[model samples]
Target: MNFYDFKFVFYLAISWCNLLEVDGITVAEQLKDVLMEGYDSSIRPVNNERDILIINISMNTMSVLTLDPAEETINFSSEFILQWKDEFLFWNKSDYNITWLKLKESFLWTPDTTVSTSIDTNYLIDASERYVSVKHDGTVRQSIYAVFTNLCDMNVDKFPYDQQTCMIKMGPWSYTTQEVTCIVGRDIAPNDTDFGDFHGNSEWDFEGIVSSVGETEDPDVNFTFSEVHFALTVKRRPQFYVWVLLIPTYIITVVCIFGLFTPTANHGLREERVNLGITTLLSSAVILQIVANAMPKTSELPLLGNFILAEIFVVAIGVLFAVLVLTLHQRAHTREWRPPAWMLWILRMTGSSKFLSRNITKIRHKSSTAERIHYTGEGAYLFKNLDESLQSVREYIQEEDRDYFRELTYVKFFDRLDFLLLFIFQVGNALVTLFLVKQ
Candidate 1:
C-alpha cells in the first residue's frame, strides 16, 4: 500500500504542474529563443550580405544653450529620430500575442551615426537610457537625446545684429555608402514644436532649419559614406549689447563734447577739456576690452569696435584743439596785442563777432575800418626814428596801432575759436555715429 500509493501521487502532482497556464515571461522566452537564434549585431540585419540598408533619420532641436564667438562653437540640445528595418528581429504577432517589443538598444543592432562637426574628437550620442522599439513588421525605431557641441560659421561684422549658421553632419562612422545610406527625412520636421515649455536660445533666436543628404569621402580610408546635414540659422538678440555696451559709450562721447565747450573761466578749457578727454578715453578703453573679450581675434574691425574707436578719436581731437584755443587766449597777456586783419574779417564773416565779444557791439569794432592796420610795439618804436618829413605819417600809423589792438583782442580770437570748434566737433560726432550705423 505504501510504495504504489506514493508513486501514483507523485505522477499526479507532475501532471498538474505541466497543465498550468503559460504567462508573459513564458511568451517572451519563446520569442527570444526563436528571434535571437543566430542574431549577429556586427553584420547588417539582412538575409543577403550585399544588400544596402537605408536608415531614415531626423533631428529636432529642443533648445540652444550658448554660442561662443571667441571659441567659434555652439551648443544645442536635440533629439535624433532614427528608423530602420531589421529582418532578423521580425516575428508573427499572433504567435506571441504582442504587436511590438521594447528592448534595450544594447541588445539590438543600432546605426553608428557620427557627428562629423563635433568639437569633441571622441563625441558620442549616448543612448544608455533609451530603448529600441521593434514592431511586428520588422521595423525598428529609436530616439536618442544628445547635446551637440559643434563648429559654427559666425559673422560678427554686425555683432549685435548678426546671424550665424552651423552645420551638423551625421553619417555611418565605419560603413561606406555601398554598405549603408542615411536619408534626411524632409517631411519629418514636425518634432520641433515649442510645446510651451521650450526654452529658446538665451542670447539668440532660433531662425530656421534646413536639411539635405549627400555623400562624403573619408580622406584616410578613401571610403565614400552617406551623410545627412542639418543647417541651423540663428539671429542674435541685441538688447544686452545695446543697453550695456553701446549706449554708455555714446553718452560718454556726447558729454565729453559738451564739456569741451565749458567757459574757460575757472580751470581754463585746456586743463578741463584734456582731463575730460582722458577720462573718456580710459572709459572707452575699458568698454573696448569688454567687447574684445567677447569677440574672436580678427584683422578687420567690427562695427561696434569702429564706433568706439571713432569716439576716442573725436575726444582726442577736442582735447588737442582745446589746447590750441587756450594758447590763443594767452596772446592777450597785456591787452595790447592785436589780431591780424584776416582774423577780424573771419569773425565778422561768420556772424560770430557779437558772440565772441560777450555783448552786441564791442567785437571787431575798428577805429576807421579802412582795411585795418598792422603794427607791433617794435614797429611803433622804429617809426619814431624815421625822418621829420614823415613824422605826421608815422604818428598817424602809431595811433592806428592802438585801434588794431582795441578792435580785435586775443581774447576775441580765443572766443571765436571756441564757437567754431564746438560746431565742428558736434557735426563730426554726428557724422561718425551715422556712418558706423549705416555701414
Candidate 2:
C-alpha cells in the first residue's frame, strides 16, 4: 500500500507541473495577439493631433539610365531607405527574446510619400522586395529599390556645352506638412563615394548631388506640403558633337568662302562655285536640323543655333558675291556703253586711280606724238585741211582711248570689289565664330 501510493502521488505531481507549463506557454502567445488585436495599419503612430509623423529619407543613386532632352526626362536607378518611429510597435526585447523583427511592408505602417516627378508610362523600371524592420525602440526602417524616370526641365540655351540640373522630388501625396514632415536620413551624404559605380549613361558626366527641403502650398489639396529634393548636377560631354556636327559645319562654311575665288569668266567654273555655295548652305541646314532634333523644343534659340545661322549668312554672302562678279563681267562685254561717272569715281576711290591715270597719260602722249609727226611730214597740205582733218583724227583717237580705258576699268573694278568683299567676309566670319564658338 505504501509503495503504490508513493508512485501514484509522484505521477500526479508531474502531471500538474506539465499543465502549468502549457498554460504559461499559452499566456506568452496571447501577449503578441493582444498587442496586435486593436492595431490599425492605416493610422499614424502618434498619440496627439499636434504630433508630427517625421520620416527620415536617404537615397543612393545606382546609375544614371538616360537623359533625353527631347523628352524632357531623366531616367535613373536608386536605393531609398526610409525610417520612422512607430510608437505602437514598441516592445520589451527581453520579454520576446528578440532584438529585431523583419516584416513585410503590408504588416506595418509607412509614409504616404511618393516621387512627384515620376513619368506616367513607366513609373518604375525595376523594384526590389519591400522590407520593413522593427527595432526594440519601435523604429521602423524600410529599404526600397526602384528605377525612376523623373521630369527634368532643360535649359538648352547653351546646348551641347550645357550643364543640367535634374531633380528627384518626393513628398506625401495626401498629407499636409502639419501632419507629416520629411527630414534627411542619418546618412546625409547619399551616393557620395559611389559615383564611379554609375554606368548607364555615356553622354552625360555626373557632376555632383545636392539635397534640400522645400515647402509649397497646394490649392487643390488645400494644404501646404513639404518636399525633399535630390538635385543631380550633370554636364554634357560635347566631344561627340564637336567632331560630328561642329567640325563638319565649319568645314562647309570655309569651303563656301573659298568658292568665291573661282573664276567667273568660265561658265563651268562659275556654276561649280555656285553649286558649292548651295551645297554648303544645305549641309549647314542639315546640321542645324540634327542639332535641333537632339535638343528640347524651346522658344529661345541655342548658341549652336546662332552659330549655324551665322555660317549660313556667310555662305549666302559668298553666293551673292559670285553672282555680282558674273554680272559685272557680262556688263563689261558691252563695248558701246561707258560706266557712269559716279561708278568710275567709286572704282578710283577703291585703289584703281593710279592705274587709270597711268593708262590715260600713255594714250595722251601717243596722240600728241602722232599729230606732231603728221604735221611735220605735210606742212603745206596739213595747213589747207588742218581744222576739219585734225578734228576728225582727234575725235577718232579719243573714242579709241575711251573704249580701252572703259574695258580696263571694268576689269579693275570687278577685281577690287571681289577682294574687298572676300576680306570683309573673312573678318566677319572670324569675329562671329570667336563670339559664338569660343564663348
Candidate 3:
C-alpha cells in the first residue's frame, strides 16, 4: 500500500491491461490470418488473355480533293486515310503487293466458269495497241464508271448533269488480285451541254488514283499500294437497239429510193414517191431518236445519225431530180425544139429517112411486090453523116441548156453537198471527241 506498493500495483494493472490488449490483438490477428487463408484458398486469380492489338477499322466517309488539270497529266488523290479506334495496323511492304493493293472486282455479265476462257480485258488499259493488246504493263490511276439500270431515261445531256447512283468497281490489271474499300462520297453529276445530234443519255464516268493503306481479310496489317490510276471510259452498251432500228430504217430507205424510179406518168406515182420519201425520212429520224435515247449527249454529233440524215437527203434529192426531169420533158414537148430544116435536108439526102420510110412501107405493104436490097457506098456514107449530125444537135442542146439544167439539178447537187458536209463534220467530230474524251 505504500508508494512503491501503489506504483507496483499500478504497473501490475498496466501490465495486466497490456496483456489483455495483447491477447485481444493476438485473437484479432489470428482471425485475420484465418480469414485471409480461407479467402486465398477459396478463390483463384483471374487470367486475362485478351489480344489488344487487333482492331476493326471502318471507312464511312469520303472526300474528293480539288484536281489540278494544268499538268498535261493530272493526278487526283484522296484525303481519306484508314484509321482504327484502338490499335493501328502493323503493315509492311513485303507482306503484300502494297504497290498494287487497291481493291477491284471482276465485272462480268456472266462469270466465266472456265479458268482459261478468252476474256476481253476485265479492266481498261491504255496502250499503244488497243484491240489485240493484253498485258499487265500499264500506269495505275483512280478512275470509275457509273452504270445505271435504265439508261434510256437518264438525262445525260442535261446541263450540270445530276449526280446519279451507280455501281462502282475499283481495282488493277486484268490479272492482278486487288482489295479495296471506300467511303461513299459526293455524287458526280454530268455537265450540261447541248450536243447536236448527240443523245443526252451518256454513261457516267470518274477518274482518280487510289492508294492502299491496309490489307483486307487480315487484321492489323498494312501494304504499300501503287497509285491505282483509272480513266473512266464508259462505252454505250448498244442493246442491239441501234442495229434493230437500223435494219428497218435501211429497208425503208431503199424502198423510198425505188420510188424514185417509178414513172411519174403513172397515176399518182409522183405524189406517192414524194410521200414515200417524206415518210422514210421521218421514220429514219424516229429510229435515230430511239438510238439517241440509249446514248450519251455531248457537245458533239452522232455518226450514225449523220449517216441516216445523209441517206434521207439523198432520197429527197432523187425526188427533186425526178420532178425536174419530168418538168423539162414536158417543156420540150410544148416548145417544139424539133429538128431544123437543114438537119432534115441532110438527113433525107443521107437516106436515113428513106430507110425509115422503107421499113414502115414493109409493114404497110404486106403481100405487095417490094424489092429489098442491102446497099452500101453512097447509102452508108449518107447514113453516117446523118447520125453524126443528130449526135451533134443533142450535144449542142444539152450544152446550151447546161445552166438551166444545173439549176434544175438542185436535188442531185444537194445529195452530193450533204455527203461532203457530213463527211467533213464527222472527221472533225472524231478528232474533237478523241481529244475531249482523252483522260
Candidate 4:
C-alpha cells in the first residue's frame, strides 16, 4: 500500500475504535456492581473482628449569639465535620470519575453520637442540610451545621473583666473505645475568615478556640469511650459596666465628700449638706442593687461587688461625718462643751489660719487671755459695793463669755475636721479605686 492508503487505513481504524467507546459507562457499571456486592447498610464497615471504626471530628464556629453568665450557658452556631472510612463505598477514581455522592442517596452507616453532649434538644435550631464528600479510598466526610445553646460552668468572680472557657463535647452514645474512637480532625481549627462575621455580643468578645480529644470512663457501662472536646475562650467586655454601674457609683461617693465642707454657720445649710449625704448614700445602694441583679447569686464576691462595697463604705462615712458636724453645731448653740485637751492641741497644730474667718483667731486668743485674768481676780471691779454691784457685773461677764464660746466652738472644730477628713478620703479613695481596677 502507498503512504496515502496507509494514512487512510489508520484514520479509519481510529474512527472505528471511537465508535466502540468502552471506557466511562462500562467502568461505572462494573464499579457499581462491585460496591453493591454483599453490602449491608445497617452493619458498620469493619473488615475483621479486630477492626475498629474511627471518626475524625472538627468544627468551624460561625457566630456567638449570647453568653449568659447567670444561666451558665452559651449560645453559638457552628459547623461540625465528621469523617470516617466506609469500605462499601470504595471505588477507583481512575476507573470511574465519581468522587462523591449525596448522603441521602448513599447507604452509609453513621455513628450514634451525632449530636453534641451539651446540646439543647428542646429548641432544635439547626438549619443546615446533611452533606457528604467521598474520596477514592472510601473516606466519607459529613458536615452538620447547628446552633447550640450549651451548658457551661462559668467562674464569674472577676465579672465584666473576666475570661471564660466554654466547651462543646461530642462523644458516642453507646460505643466504647474498643469498637469506635473519635479523634480531632486535621485542619480543624477555627476559621479566621468567619470571625469578621461574628454576631456582635454586647457583653462578650470572642478570643479564640482550642480542640482536644480524650477517652472518658463510664462507670455504669464499665467502658471507656472516646470524646472530642472543643473549648471556646471569650472575654467579658467591661466598658458597659464601667460607664453604667462603676463610674456613676464612684461619682456619687465622691460628691458625698463635699458635704463635709458645707458651712456650719447656717443651720439650714448644715441640714442641706446632711440631706445631700443621705441622698448620695441611697444612690450608691441603688447602684449596688442593679449590679447584684445583673449577676448570679453566689457565695464568692466579684470584683465589681467588692468595688460597690467600698463605695458604700465611703458614702456611709460621709453620712456619719455629716451627722457628727450637725451634732457639734447643735451642741455649741444649745450648751457649752469643751473639746479634750489633746484634741484641742491637734486642732491648733493642723489648723490653717488662712482658711479661718478674718480676725477670728485673734478674737479667740483675746478671749482666752481675758478668761484667765477674770478667773485670777486680776480684773478691776466696776462698782465698790461688795454684794449688789459685784453680782450685777458678774452676770454681765457670764453673758459675754457664753456668747464668745458659742461663736468659736462648732465652727472652729468643723473647719479642722473637714480638712482632716478630706485628706483621708482623697487618699483612701485613690487606693481603693486603683486596687479594684487593677484586679
Highest-scoring model, lDDT: 1
Residue-level lDDT tens digits of model 4 in 57-114: 8775447788877788888877777889987687667555667645442445777664
Model 1 poorest 10 in a row by lDDT = 357-366
Candidate 4 stretches greater than 4 Å from native: 1-38, 114-129, 186-200, 260-268, 349-409
Better of 2 and 4 by lDDT: 2
Across 1-439, the per-residue lDDT of candidate 3 in tens digits comes to 6899899899997886576456467433433343234233211111232332111121122222221111111112212112111111113334221322221222101111111111222323332222211112211222322111111123233212222222222321121123222222322223312211111232323322222222223234434221221112122333353456544655565566556554323323445555666777788778767646544654443555455555566666766755754454444334423333464453333232322121111112223234332348868877856755665676566554653443333333323333343354345434433443331
Residue-by-residue lDDT tens digits, candidate 1, 1-439: 6999999999997775454325534556667667777787777787888999999988644467889999999888777778999988888797677788887787778888878898763224556656788898889998777777889876798877888878888888888888889888662232346421233466887776678998888798788999899887788888898899888888898888878866444224367677888898899999888888889898766778888888889988888887766665654443434455587786664443333332222323234546434446856656544533264565566556645554454445565656777788989898898888677
lDDT of 3 at 103: 19
Error of 4 at 259 (Å): 2.3
Q: What is the lDDT of residue 260 in candidate 4?
A: 53
Whole-model lDDT, candidate 4? 0.69
Tens digits of per-residue lDDT for model 2 on 1-439? 6999999999997886576457466433444464567888888888787899898877754577789999999988877778888888777876665666776677566787788888742325232346578787889887666777889999988777888988878878878889899887432333456433433368887776677787778788578988888887778888898888777877778767866753233423565677788888888888889888888879877888878888999898789878766765675564333445576665555454433342332323233654454433547675747655666688678867766765676666666565666677878888888888876
Clashing pairs in 1: none
Better of 3 and 4 by lDDT: 4
- In model 3, which regions exceed 4 Å deviation? 1-234, 237-239, 263-268, 292-297, 337-439
TM-score of 1: 0.77
Off-target runs (Cα >4 Å) in candidate 1 are 1-29, 121-129, 187-199, 263-269, 332-346, 349-413
